[model samples]
Target: MAHIRSRKHAAAPQPAHTALALAALTMPMTLLAQQAAPAAAGAEATLPEVKARAAAETPYKADAVASPKFTQPLVDTPQTITVIKKEILQQQAATSLTEALRNTPGITMQLGENGNTTTGDSIFMRGFDTTNSIFVDGIRDLGNISRDVFNIEQVEVVKGPSGSDNGRGASSGYVNLVSKTAAREAFGNASIALGDASRVRATVDLNRPLDIALPGSAVRLNVMAQDFGVPGRDEVKAKRWGFAPSLAIGLGTPTRTYLNYLYIDQKNRPDGGVSTFGLPAYNFGANTPGAAVDPKNYYGSRSDFDDVTLHMFTARIEHDFGRGTVLRNTTRLGHTEQDFVLTGVNAVTATAADPASWTVARSRQARHQTNEILTNQTNLNTEFATGGVSHSLSTGFELIHERQNQVNAQTLTNTTLPASLQQAVANLYRPNIDDAFLMPPFKGAYAKGSTLSAAVYAFDTLKLSDAWLLNAGLRWEKFHTETNGATFTAATATLPESLVQNAPLSLTDNLLSWKLGAVFKPTADGSVYVTVSNAYQPPGGANHALSTSATNQASPSLEPQEGSNLEVGTKWDLLGGRLAATAAVYRSENRNELVSDGATPASFSQVGRRRIDGVELALVGQLTPAFNLSAGLAYMDPKIVRGVPGATGNQGGAIVYSPKVTFSSWATYKLAFGMTLGGGVRYVDPVVRNSNLNNATSANLPGTESYTVADAMLAYEVTKNVNLQLNVYNLFDRQYVAAVNNGGSRYVPGQPRNVLLTANVAF
Candidate 1:
């Protein structure tokens, strides 16, 4: 059989709404002349309020979200949300978004499929795939790549159906990353760090006011560079660098304009993972399994590599219309390019009696892909009163164009060589990195697709009384997607080889989603609320590519999947509003799944259903004047009520990769002499890789076992402008499996004990 190859294009056409979007942005500038007098007067009133709030803010707590759609403060919001401030990330020395997410519960990582290794942050949340539900500054950030936090100020996680907040997305929830921008202050900060595994990193953040040319104007810049290698895994290394710049004008005035840009470049050696032939329940020709293989074994060739380049540009305008009303408009252009070639262990050949003679089959995989997005959004927020009822209303309109192009490759072995070498086989016990292997050449096959969407949404929060409040939101969206691709097939007996170039396929869908909530405030610092929300996932929603297979869920002929959630929660502020506590119980369900319909010709229908019932608890903010804490616990029960019979891991049992119980907590205390000590513990229950009617593991072997890990941090403030910090990860050096492939053929081992020390300077 021949492989299907693909390639990507570097450029794409601008969206049709570009002109209109630009008009919306420039229209506000015309009001600058008329509002000059009022703007100056308004500036005087806003500056003092901002200064006072900044002086009273806490390091680890946020009172409200950056988005204007959420009209109420955190205490009054009905949804389940967690905000991880930059201070927490700094103290922990977290470099990637994956490490920062450890502060939350009920999230798991995923290894790739049977033949390939997953790269980047492949996140699973609340029993659903949330890899594509990440956003930056209220706009979707689409790609499969690791994200650095050097330019990030905070991370906000919202759990539950949120179609009203954004557009179509996963059933679980979404994450929003807040970027650091210009501020009306002069400050500079820098850090340099060194760690085990030849790790080195440096970062800098600087902000300054430019009042000489434009009053109230400011500029900010952030830069990062890193080079590191995996401690236990040999020949695996990553090198990356990035920079972000932001400019703001009229910050304190009634009209504000902002410009921002970001650029990143990465080069890395990917890991393919170790074979699972000797592990428990790994049967080889009816032979009993043996001891596990060395976790440090590097099975891939040294030629494998992954590289990425990213660029983004944004412009925003905000104009105060006076009387508690504001108008805002934003435009963004983002592009990402990635190319990778990796070697994975596919199967084990244990025919030899000696374990040293055993070998594992290797498979080559490569992809050249590019993702591009252009979006424009306009919003209006106002406060009004009618019939003695006060209302806070938020309305917005959005236009988006997202596209993805991927070029695949076919691998051909050098059959002239020896059998073992030509077959791409590596010794199971002792694999060599300098092995003879052939690099795959790119063919002409590729896949290209794009999605265009137009949407309008509105949200209203009504104060029925001092003790009662009602919140409602609704969104209507229309989307169109087009796909074009080609595939190849090798020649067979009595048949000639062929290359099939498919005609353009298109899908159009209209979606309506909403949410409703009611809150009851029994006291000044506490509230109870109940909310119901729904979201939709249409064909080509997560990715732009559409499939032609009848059984595939991304078939354009299929109906969109529907998800709903019902949650009841309560929140309280304690110790004179220094601490926040929250608890919630929720049930979420997804319907319209594509499944085989037991028919003679094998028909399919959209009658499948699945559900998850969970309980969550959280605490954040200062426990006392000298202590701070952030912690969360989650208990999830996932089940499939209907599905295809005998489907791997889908037999009326718990969903694959979904843990039952997860807990995470971190706390720090300030001591005398400007010293601080912090530590955290994380726990995850066992998960089943395969399921039958009895919900048993596959082949009667146990699934991934549960594990507990701990981390510690110590910091000393030598002076007001200088500090030193150290972080220790996996202090106990516990050996465990971090992730396993769906077929149970391979696994990635957890990181061993490692430490890093840094010197931080601020002025």
Candidate 2:
């Protein structure tokens, strides 16, 4: 049994100001203790477990994941699910969600924000943008901020429409982050790392059983601080710090309660990236439209920045009725805010004939956005036998109340520019500009809205016989949203309403999502399955803020987008059920997509359609006791089936950011003397932009090109309680595009070769 000899935090006391900020996040709750030094602590290591049990949990590498409400093993579930565990993250030194997701297949990043707001985690899977389809511990995170993984236990990428799991999952799928919680153990671990470009990061984790007399009671704390620079970019950097704490009462008892909280503060020197102009179809040859700028060029001002803050608190209770019945309830409150300015660019003189003459017209966008959510969930799980069959059933319900606020206005250039937004000139070929430290002047509010949603769902897995299994689920949701309709003048001398007109607002929608599947198990380690699922996304909630009906009165007809997926897949447990592999063929489509009606100006109809046909392959887990591997590949064709007359290009063509092929693979092997080696590669095919698709000018749009990058890692366990590790990213230092500025001229440059060395010690 694990026992504690002393009661102390894991780290040193935080500064008074920092302490105050943390205290605000812990308002009603109590801050038990921060992590203290591990010098006198006892070192411990054991297999992963959701809760304390008599036996240590089995490690299947990346084979199994329990997300939100899932109780079945990934191999037993019918849908395609990819699980990335803590071990995999450490091996890759992936500190953020984006870095970790790049290791999967068919994923791309897009810039999110209006004007100068580039603070969103614009991730796409399959062929659709899934920026809002992010969840933390089953609750929607409800913002466009990049999320950190410092306190996450694992990440589950559920492929395909997931409205049944979330109210408004993206057409392609959703990402669920399972956070670390209080565990019944007495162990502590800490790590500090440094890398290229003056990168510095420190992290700590401590889990302590609180009381000896109490059978099940413990508290866990996690903290992280980091300051890092973009290896290839000039003056681009990111800095952040956060803390997570969880406490459990009656952890190992029949009746248990848990409380979890998270707080994060971040600031970044945003990168607008390189331009997409003149390049050879294959190289910078004379064939393409314009010259390719050096990958290291900085087109945006160095003073551009993105700042964000996030806080969340959750409470959960569970009761076991013995005999295979359990009840669980969870409630969470979350808030997030973002402020930033991004450099917008227009090609002025970029041409292949005079490649060196390329210059860009530059402007700035300033934005402030905020979101808040209060949600609750309850579920009942039970197993019973009837007649000649056994059934595992789960039923749940959820309630959510959310609010979104956005105020976007650029800096006013009050001079010869005649009170216009900030405007400037930039030399794209070779930047000669410097940071101006310009920020947006006071502007009126543009959008304020609130939403309330409720849903009830049930799922059942029936074992008709030993060889065949059936699964079915259905969810009924009621959603309502409306504009706050508040008026504010900003108390200015001449407040022009032009800067604050209310966009289309107000909506009421009822959504029904469902799933069905059948499985044939020919062997204990293998199964073949067919599954069908559907999701509903209401009109005007695409960006979380609904379009006011008043602003969209011209177009009277609107409806929720309908998406469906049909897949046939097979999963196998190889090498004595220690390794797992999955292969699937599927078609996913979205119908009734909102598009403008040719006959009417500013009017739209749900007559558009988009679809993707694809095949996916994944292999995860151990090939041998000493070797672990995870690999995935996807081939997809996404196209538009309808068009808008005035939308200019992008119709009847491949969608933006949807690559035809993407592949990733990572493997680790253990050698003698506690040494391990790891390596992986990522490949992405060329991608197009929506606004310029199918246009002759597309050559000037700077589309993403096909590229392959590799990464490597080396680690040695000096002792059972100490380990040393190193990770090298972009091993070949390939120059490539990481992301486009989302329907804009600015594109992101990929990272250069950089290395991080870490010393991890456990007590």
Best by TM-score: 1
Per-model TM values vs. the true structure: 0.92, 0.87
lDDT per residue for candidate 2 within 1-763, as digits (tens), equals: 4322211111110001112223344332222211211221222112132243221222325544554245455666788888788888877888999988976899999864323435567888999878878877767777767788889878889999878877676789898787888887799989999998889999999999996676688888899999998787777778999998887766645556677788999998777656666544422223335546677776666667889998887877665554456666667777888887766554455454565655666666667888998776777877788999888777999888888888765443323134343346556677754645366554545677777899999888888887898988889998877774333344346765444354455677788899899999998778999999998777545555554443342122466778899999999887776778899999999887766655544666667788999999999888877888899999999988775654464467787789999999999999999999999999999887553344434434546779999999999999999999999999998987788665445677788889999999999
Q: Model 2 misses residue 459 by how many Å?
A: 0.7
Candidate 1 weakest lDDT stretch, 10 residues: 7-16
What's model 1's TM-score?
A: 0.92
List runs of model 1 lying over 4 Å from the truth.
1-55, 280-287, 411-420, 491-499, 598-601, 646-649, 691-702
The best candidate by lDDT is 1
Per-residue CA lDDT of model 1 for 519-588, tens digit only, reads 9999877889999999999987888888988788889999999889999999997777778899999999
